[model samples]
Target chain A: MLEARVYVIMKPGVLDPQGKAVKSALDSLGFEGLKDVRVGKYFAIKLDDISKEKAMERLKGMCEKLLANPVIEDYKIEILDIKS
Target chain B: MLEARVYVIMKPGVLDPQGKAVKSALDSLGFEGLKDVRVGKYFAIKLDDISKEKAMERLKGMCEKLLANPVIEDYKIEILDIKS
Candidate 1:
């Protein structure tokens, strides 16, 4: 089995309203030293036994086709562990 | 300045409908070697100059108060970088 983690985040120029809301909430709550906040998505996946190279390739496919929106978001994949 | 990343995930026993939906979507998309999928939230935060220890402490507060729900989710914080 193989396990992988994917992180999906908005591109630098994109506006993130949720993150903005969080920043303001924190500010009201008295938290200091805050400059910016951005929110994204995380996914942990389990897959049948596969080579690391193959897993990476498959993950990329999944990210492009379904997991992330290429227009405004970027995704990164990390293969966490493999077990036979 | 300090940059930190936070990962929020559902507790192991919690239901993740979004992950299930993704898994089914992938299954229908003809991708093979699938087992399971779980989805979560990611946050990237930038802060004004602060010590690593202080940053961590403040981040935990934010997570507890606004970032994550303690009832069903767990959060992990990583101090990505700090620059003066």
Candidate 2:
């Protein structure tokens, strides 16, 4: 099995209202000195007996096709571990 | 400045239809052999000069109060950097 994480976030120029809300909420609560808060989606995936190469290829494909919207979001993938 | 990440995922017993949908989507798309998939929230936070000690304390508060649901989710925090 292979363990992976994918972090999906809005692209640099995108307007992030969810982030802004969190920041403002924090401000009200006096959690001060926060420069920014950008919220994103994290996916933890376990793949069954797939070769690393195939896993890599398939993972990227998943991100591009469904996991992230290429038009406005960016995604980073990390392979955490592979165990049989 | 400090850069941090909070990964929030549902606990083991929570029903995660979002995860199941993604897995089934992968199956339809011919990305076979996925053992399990869990989707979560990833927050990228930037703090302005709050001492790491204070930041740590506030971060935990954020998670408990708004960032995560104590009844269903578990969160992990990582301190990526503290830039001077």
Candidate 3:
């Protein structure tokens, strides 16, 4: 089995209201050091008996197809530990 | 500078509507062998000259204060590498 870790973030220049809301909330709560809070999505998946390349391909397809909004978001994937 | 990696996941037993929607979409797209799609959040932060413990305390505060919805999510933090 292999584990895939996926991260999806808003594309540069895209407005992230959620992130902004959080940043404002933080500022109000006295956390003055935080700036540019960009909210993102994360996913962890376990695949059975698949080669890393094929699994990554399928995972990327999943991201592009449904996991992310390509018009406003960009994504990156990292493969964590793999176990047989 | 130190790097912080925060992972916030929906509490177990909480219904993840987004995850379910993604799962169904994947099924429709003919990607079989996938189940239990849990969605989460990831953050990568660069902290300046802060002790690891202090940084963690403040980061945890941020998670509890703004980054996570305490009612439905739980978070874990990983201090990646620290460089002086």
Q: Per-residue lDDT for B57 in model 2?
A: 86
| Each prediction's DockQ against the real complex | 0.91, 0.89, 0.51
State the displacement of the C-alpha of residue B66, model 1, in Å, after optimal TM-score superposition. Answer: 0.8
Candidate 3 lDDT tens digits, A18-52: 87776678779987465456778898666665777
Candidate order by DockQ, decreasing, is 1, 2, 3
By TM-score, how accurate is candidate 2? Answer: 0.94
Provide the overall lDDT of each model, using Cα atoms, as 2-decimal numbers. Answer: 0.94, 0.90, 0.80
Which is the better candidate, 1 or 3, if ranked by TM-score?
1
Winner by DockQ: 1
The order by descending TM-score is 1, 2, 3
Candidate with better DockQ, 1 vs 2: 1
Report chain A TM-scores, every model.
0.94, 0.93, 0.93
lDDT of 1 by residue, B1-84 (tens): 889999999999999999999999999999998999999999999999878899999999999999999899999999976546
* Interface DockQ of candidate 2: 0.89
- Per-residue error for A21 in candidate 2, Å, reads 1.3
